[model samples]
Target: MPLPKPPVRRARNKEDNELLIKGMTCALIGAVVLLAPYLAKSASVQDLMRQAYLVGWFALILGCAFLGRYALRRLAAHRSAPRG
Candidate 1:
């Protein structure tokens, strides 16, 4: 009897999926920023700005973390590649 084959993984498709997720994350962040003011009642302008800044910082950090990792990987790949 023949053994079952393992699943094949594609690198390009995984990269595309990561990009789509990053874009969607940005979109959701934008929507949240736009809706923040109207969503909070009895909140002062100062409070709203503080909340927005915190939210924005969190998103920025998360996105940058992934981007930094991706950039580091590409840099390492280039460093290892032979130059003509």
Candidate 2:
């Protein structure tokens, strides 16, 4: 048997704006997490470069955790919204 296609619904302006805001916030947070260590440092060019490299991985892990928590919160909020 073949699977059926799901129907598509257009979003209202408010919904679109909400999604846009969420996307922007996520991007901003991702950028900040990726830049945090360099933003914290006072060092020579070589040391900064080294720090940058190490911080990339550190920030990636941190960002993953942050994003996970963010998504989990959103999911919980979604579940709680209409039933209350």
Candidate 3:
């Protein structure tokens, strides 16, 4: 019997997935910021602001991490690419 063919490669790569996930993460952060006050109107506004601030920081860190990873990968690829 003939051997099976190799699996097909996907068009999307690791960086694309990372970008998608980061985007979703940031969107959730925004959603939380918008939803928190409505969900807990009785609580002090200052407390909600504090919670949103924390979420903002997390979103910032996540975006930075993704950006750094993407940059390093592209730089490595550029350095390793064959020059004509």
User: How many clashing residue pairs appear in each of the predictions shown?
Assistant: 0, 0, 0
lDDT of 3 by residue, 1-56 (tens): 97776554344356556775785677567556656676666669747665676676
TM-score for all models, in order of appearance: 0.46, 0.38, 0.50
lDDT of all predictions: 0.64, 0.56, 0.65
Lowest-sum lDDT 10-residue window in model 2: 5-14
Backbone clash pairs for candidate 1 read none
The candidates, ranked best first by lDDT, are: 3, 1, 2
All models, RMSD in angstroms: 8.0, 10.2, 7.1
lDDT of 3: 0.65
Highest TM-score scorer: 3
- lDDT for model 1, on a 0 to 1 scale? 0.64
- Index of the highest-lDDT prediction: 3
For 1-84, candidate 2 gives per-residue lDDT tens digits of: 866654443453345446545655655655665565566555665465555554555555555565566566567757855442
Residue-wise C-alpha lDDT for candidate 1, range 1-84, written one tens digit per residue: 966754544684487458557855865685566566777675795477556766766775666666666667667757966575
